[model samples]
Target: MRRVRYYQYGGPEVLTVEDVDPPAPQAGQVLLRVEAVGVNFVDTRFRRGPGSGSIFERPLPGRPTGDVVGTITRVGPGGDARLIGRRVAALAEDAYADYAVAEAQWLAPVPENLGAGDASMLAMSAPVALRVLRSAPLRPGDTVLIHAAAGGVGHLAVQLAKLLGAGTVIGTARSARRLDFVRSVGADVAIDYSEPDWPDRVRAAAPGGVDVVLDAVGGPVLQASLDLLAPFGRAVVYGAATGKLEHVPVVSLFALRSVTGFNLTAWRRANPDEARREMDELTDLFAAGRLRATVHAGLPLTEAATAHQLIESRSHTGRVLLLPGGLGPGAA
Candidate 1:
């Protein structure tokens, strides 16, 4: 089996694929014949560090961590044997590998109608999207702003916002095409965040102020989003992709504006049953036509470096996938 690994942290070039014997799953884990891997920006951050700050404490010889959609070929002790041959999606152990192990209880069954790429979102992105939106006080008719709104979770957040009764969905991305993709996915307005006066544009669109913000790109962007919130509005911070999570300012909190931080693992641990319900709801939404997963590109496993490059550069509009089991559904 081929797996992506990095001995030293640096640029995309550091990631190298090596052929190795596949390992068996440990107790409570299931071995999967990975069909596709979702390439995420966080993998790039982990690849560039001996310690990727407070969020990721990755060590040497690190591999990408991501969502994987595959078939359960074998089950380890404590795992259900009946799951063998079941198509499912889970956050994989050493996710970039052609074969990986996943926690059996944490995994979700992939609906027959859903493709591999969309199923991958069910593992991580879609649930996060749904949770972050719900983290804040999101009411019907609220105006919502989704930063990086054309990326994996952002794209899904845009649609879910509308479905959850957001009156106006404002999306922010770096490129024209990304803005268009956000619009295509039901955003009421799309703005280019790369512009210096982008917040002004957002202000123009909302007129009063944004009611809710779903932010992953922290730092100045997060601060700006917080600054633009209307009275009684809320902002949910889920990630710090900019490498800096900002501190809330006193002024931003005035006028009843509030900020909340969310971590997927934390949320799952804190609200196990509700977390499971959220996952099921997202999966069901995708299974129906209510949700759509926009895939930017599906490349071969060998091009893991290129996938990282796309994510790091913010050039892709949605989830960039890797085909580990060759070209299948949602893979080119």
Candidate 2:
């Protein structure tokens, strides 16, 4: 089996592909012949260096972990034998490999009609976007503002807001291309957040002030977002991908507003049923052709480093996938 590993924290160059023995599944786990890997912005953050959101207490060897769609080849003790040949999507650690292990209990059976890349998007990004929007408790006819609206979660959130009944959807991106893409995805308005007067522009579009803010870009953008909220409005910060220090500006108690965050793991643990419901909703939307994940590019498994580069560059319009090509039951 081949996998990507980095013993030290650094840039994309640290990721190396090597052939090694495939890992066996543990109790309640199933081994998958991984078909595709989702490259998340947070995974790049984990690779760059230590951060407050890191999964580890100290720097350690890193193996990219993200959404993986694959076929079940084997199962460990206590796992269901009948699922061995079923294709599924899962969030797995140590997953930038040809084969990865995922928990059988939570496996999402991928429909035969769903491609690996889309299944990978459904595995994580779509659900996270849904969860982020709900964090602020979006209401019908609410004026919503979405930051980084052309990125993976961002793009999905834009379309979802409309479906969820938001009256006016405002999206922001750094480049004109991205802003255009945001508008195409259902944003009623799109602004260039990179401009100095971006916030002012946002105010011009919605002078009454934004009703909900879904932000992933951190640093200055987070602070600015707080200032743009209407009285009683809410801002949900799910990630800070700026690669810079992130902090919030002070808000007066009399402001009648709030800032919240959505940590996927914690949320799932607290509201398992709701989490499942969100995924089901996304699945239905995709099936009905009302929602779809825009695939930016697909690279081979050995070129995992390049995939990470594409994500870190922030140039891609949608999800970047790594295809673990030609190592599976279907191989000739």
Candidate 3:
């Protein structure tokens, strides 16, 4: 087996691929012949330093990509034998490898019609997008704003919001090209946050301001999002891709508007059953062609460093994926 690891954290240069012995699954786990892996900002954060918070019990020299899609090759004791040879998507630690272990209970069967890359892309972002939308009070005909809407979670949030009956879907990106891409994914209005008056643009587009705002970019963007809300509108903060929101005053909540933070990792830890239900719903949506997984780039697993560079650039829209075992864009 081969895996990507880093001895010290700083930049993409630190990551190196090494050949190693394959891992054996422990009780209640299944060993997957990994087909695809999803690369996220969090993976870049982990590579840069330890500030991202720990997912493992103890800090290790290497970190894992969180989303994986593969076929079950081995099942440990207490794991379902029937799952062997089944294709599934799951959240796995140290998934930047040819094979990885995943808890059987967390695995979701991938619809046969879905490609491995799309399955891996959806494994993490779709659930988070669905959960974020559910956290807010959304009504039919309500206008919704999604910041960083061309990114992994935001792209899915755009489609899911429209499918759930949002009248107008507004998405913000950093460039005109990116905004155009966001519009193709269901955003009724696309604003380039790079523009100083992007918030003003959003207001003009929605008239009375949007009813719900999904913000992943913090700092000034979060503040701007809060200001663009209509009366009683909800702003759900999911990530701080730019930086942390600073000096948010109590006055920001005027007019019954509110700000709520959503951490998918924490939410999943607290509501396991609900998490499973959300995953099922996302899978159904994908199978029915209602949800499309946008894959920005796919590279061979050994090129993990290159993948990291693309993600950190923030220029690519949608999920970046790594294909293991010689798999490429069109592989089944």
All models: lDDT? 0.88, 0.84, 0.84
TM-score of 1: 0.97
Least accurate stretch of 10 residues (summed lDDT) in model 3?
50-59
Please give the lDDT score for candidate 2.
0.84
Better of 1 and 2 by TM-score: 1
Winning candidate number (TM-score) = 1
In candidate 2, clashing pairs total: 0
Q: Per-residue lDDT tens digits of candidate 3, residues 33-142?
A: 98888888777877777554333123558666668888999999877788899999988988899999988877889988798756875567888898888898678899
The residue-by-residue lDDT of candidate 1 on 18-53, one tens digit each, is: 999887998999999999998888889988883556
Q: Give me the displacement of residue 114 in model 2, in angstroms.
A: 1.3
Which stretches in model 3 have alpha-carbon errors above 4 Å?
A: 50-60, 245-247, 329-332
Pairs clashing within candidate 3: none
What clash pairs does model 2 have?
none
- Predicted candidate 2 versus true structure: per-residue lDDT over 62-93, tens digit per residue: 87787988899999988789998998889999
Number of backbone collisions per candidate, in order?
0, 0, 0
Using all chains and alpha carbons, the TM-scores for the candidates as numbered come to: 0.97, 0.93, 0.93
